[model samples]
Target: MATSRRVSRVAELIKREVSQMLLHDIKDDRVGAGMVSVTDVDVSGDLQHAKVFVSIYGTDEARAETMAGLKSATGYVRSELGQRVRLRRTPEIVFQEDRSIERGNRVISLINQLNQNRQIDDAVAIEEVDEFDDE
Candidate 1:
């Protein structure tokens, strides 16, 4: 089993290399159809597999297409990793779509909306109290 530190380091390296490839090396039209960014990477303890999390900004169809493109290019990405990183055995790559960022943004928006509504309700309550007090 690889140490946690080593695994994390390898994960980061893979994330960086994959991000570079997406930015410059990858030429798949489907992938280029959407704006994709590498969000995170997870490597197994044995360093035999890696999951690449990507956040794509676009419609659902575009996102799906981008994922398919990434999946199709996995072999190329893995081969590139073998050349860029000096590992005894290059890990198998798995592309996963990450929607955490979108979920987080949605949660934040809901929180803000609730806060705004609460403020408005508070103001109305204060006005009612003032009217009763004036009676």
Candidate 2:
């Protein structure tokens, strides 16, 4: 079993190597069709497996295509990782779509909208209070 610190370091290295592969080494047309980024990586305690979270910006069709491309290139990516990072055994790579960023943006937008509405209500309440004071 690996310590948490070692596992985290491995995860970071994996993320970096995979990101570089996606940016320069990968030649799949489908992957190139959209903008893709490595968002995070989670590695097992035993360091036998790693889940790579990726965020892609594009239409639904393009996202689907990019995922397919990633899936098909998994073996290649794993091989590249083994070469880039030295370890007793290279962890298996699993690609996952990360939607946390999108969800966060949506939440922020809702919050902003609510704030604007509250400001409008506050203005109306102040006007009512002023009229009452005049009376």
Candidate 3:
């Protein structure tokens, strides 16, 4: 079993190397369908598996295609990591689409919309009070 610090270090290294691969080494057309970026990497405590979180900016279909491409290229990525990283064994790579950013953006938009509606209502109330005072 690896210590927590070692596990974190490995996860960061994997994240950096995989980001480099996605940027330069990967040649899959589907991966290029969307603008993909690595959001985070989670490695198991044992260092036997790594989950690569990615945030893609595009339509739903494009996101799907990019995920499929990542899945298919797992073996290649593992091999490359094995070569570049001096680990006893390369951790298995699993690509996961991180939707947290999308969700957060949605929440922010909702809040903004609500604020606009509140301001409109307040203006209407103020106008009503002014008319009442004149009459």
Candidate 4:
């Protein structure tokens, strides 16, 4: 319970460190996408594994490249985390590309379009109803 919280904190710290490293320190060409953000981190209770959710803004190819770059650099990232976080054993980092934001935006856009269409239809229907009443 409490240990899980500690692990979660460490996971967040790792995410921050990794983000900073990617932004300023990493020199990999594959990581040269538009921007990458750490969205979520889930750490196991045993503190031996962490799942990192990352959101990338760019083309799909760029996102895939960034993911590949991160996967290749996981060992280096884990070592860096161990040095900075003072853990007995550094947890293995797993990268996952998150599309939740994209999905949410799509849903909102669909709702707005539907609402607009409904408004137009209602206006037409009301006009027809008034014409029939007059007749």
TM-score to true structure, per model:
0.98, 0.96, 0.96, 0.91
Q: What's the alpha carbon RMSD for model 3?
A: 0.9
Q: What tens-digit string does per-residue lDDT give for candidate 3 at 1-135?
A: 999999999999999999999999999999999999999999998899999999999999999999999999999999999999999988988999999999999999999999999999999999999999999
Please list the Cα RMSD from the true structure of every candidate, rounded to 1 decimal place. Answer: 0.7, 0.9, 0.9, 1.6
lDDT of each: 0.98, 0.96, 0.95, 0.85
| Candidate 4 worst ten-residue window by lDDT | 1-10
For candidate 2, list the clashing residue pairs, or say none: none
Give a tens-digit lDDT track for model 2, residues 14-131: 9999999999999999898779999999999999999999999998899999999999999999999999999999999999999898999999999999999999999999999999
Best by TM-score: 1
**Candidate 4 positional error at 66, Å:** 1.2
Q: Which stretches of candidate 4 lie over 4 Å from their true place?
A: none
1 against 4, candidate with superior TM-score: 1
Count of clashes in candidate 2: 0
Name the weakest run of 10 consecutive residues (lDDT summed) in model 2: 26-35
lDDT, ranked from best to worst:
1, 2, 3, 4
User: Following a full C-alpha superposition, what root-mean-square deviation does model 1 have from the true structure?
Assistant: 0.7
Summing lDDT over every window of 10 consecutive residues in candidate 1, give the lowest-scoring window.
26-35
